[model samples]
Target: EAGRRNLLGLRFPPKYGGRGLRWEDEIVAIGRTANTASLNADGLGIKLGEHGEVHVNASLQTTIPHIYAIGDVIRGAGLAHQAMAEAELVVEALQGAQVDATSLIVPACIYTHPEVATVGLSEEQMRAETDAVIVGEFPLRASGRAVTCNEVEGWVKIVGDKRTGKLRGVHIYASHASELISEATLAIAQGLTIDQYVKQVHPHPTISEALGEAGWVALNKPLHVPRIQRKRLRK
Candidate 1:
């Protein structure tokens, strides 16, 4: 039985796998996947849907020009920071500043063991959208701070555009990754190149240095990790 459990790619039928359950039953088994409880907006006379979401324009203006919406109520990730950013945009638009909300970079973080954080285009997205892409990574095991803290189990990865050398994305899986991702968000927002990122000096023995080192890796001048060699294909 232990050997059977260790077998790879095992499949089970209804009798053993619970496959005979109805779709609704399966949903219950897995756990409910439903939106948060939302109040209808019609009662407020705001022309909202049953979920209390309002459709807004790039400036966050609603169907009624005078009204504006932001946050989870405006159809986006229900994060407070995102809502705050959108609120700022709405204020700017109201002040007659021409705003383009689509270009906004919203950073996301997951607080877990070896925290995960990300901003901007992912590697898969860049490969699909751009002509050429470069990626670099620095493992936490190479980080002095991570080593000292005895929590070296993650990495920092940077994605860049090969044509322009501008940073396209940054992803991190490490202790305090959520905090470190703010730097990445700023880099993507400013269109910083790998060279520029490497130039910014990071404090020694700090986890933040992992980001700078990863930029160095992307530029093929890694300070800590050995460079990876690729086999050239002969024509």
Candidate 2:
């Protein structure tokens, strides 16, 4: 198995409990996490339906003053790291620091055949927030490093706050997108515009260069893609 199993406790099925002649085993570990709730009460909690969207009771609130909530309770991404960032932001706000909680961008990650990771606003959110949201996408097909690493089935997408050129989001679907997203998150955090990233000299023949290439697309100077021909009428 690809995952390591650390033993916490073991349990036998109904058969071993003096019932049916079936066999099953369950093991619970300290680090094991379940996206679903273990218990759902009448007044509070959530449960995932057959289709996987959750049914949540919005009346829930965290134990913090002038800091309403964080984590899965608020309906953003349910990643633990995202929640930690929100917690830190709330703490800073409660300390009378000039902090904006609304600026947070939740990132979603999935580790499957081709790793997936994303940060900041999605395409829909970008369209809803601004009229001039520009997206830059660079495929891994053109990446030399991807070829060298034997992993070339992914993409890097960057969403820029078009009016200000600020980086609004970055969606990385690659081998190590988890590690790559931090830089993008930092860019969004520091308010570094896409132009700044476009001017950056990324090291040669590396997966990170795909980030730089995507930035180039945002700047309208896509390096690998061929120019498109537009029909011109007689002036």
> Whose lDDT is greatest here?
1
Local accuracy of candidate 2 as per-residue lDDT tens digits, 1-235: 2232443344545322323322245545543233434334223444444433344332222322332455665555567987788778767766666665566655678886678888888767988876788777787877999999988878888888777888888999899888778778878878899999777777888898999888787667788754231111111
- Shift in Å, residue 199, candidate 1: 0.7
**Candidate 2 Cα errors over 4 Å, as ranges:** 1-69, 89-100, 229-235
- Candidate 2 contains a number of clashing pairs equal to 0
Q: Which tens-of-lDDT digit does each residue in 1-235 have in candidate 1? A: 6665554443445322233221212222342222423544455455665555687788887777788888877676667789888888888988899887777888988888879999988888988987588888888888989999998878888888888899989999898999999988998899899799889989998999999988888888888987772111111
In order, the Cα lDDT scores of the candidates are: 0.78, 0.68
The residue ranges of model 1 lying beyond 4 angstroms of the native Cα positions read: 1-53, 229-235
C-alpha root-mean-square deviation, each candidate? 8.0, 13.2
* Candidate 2 lowest-lDDT run of ten: 226-235
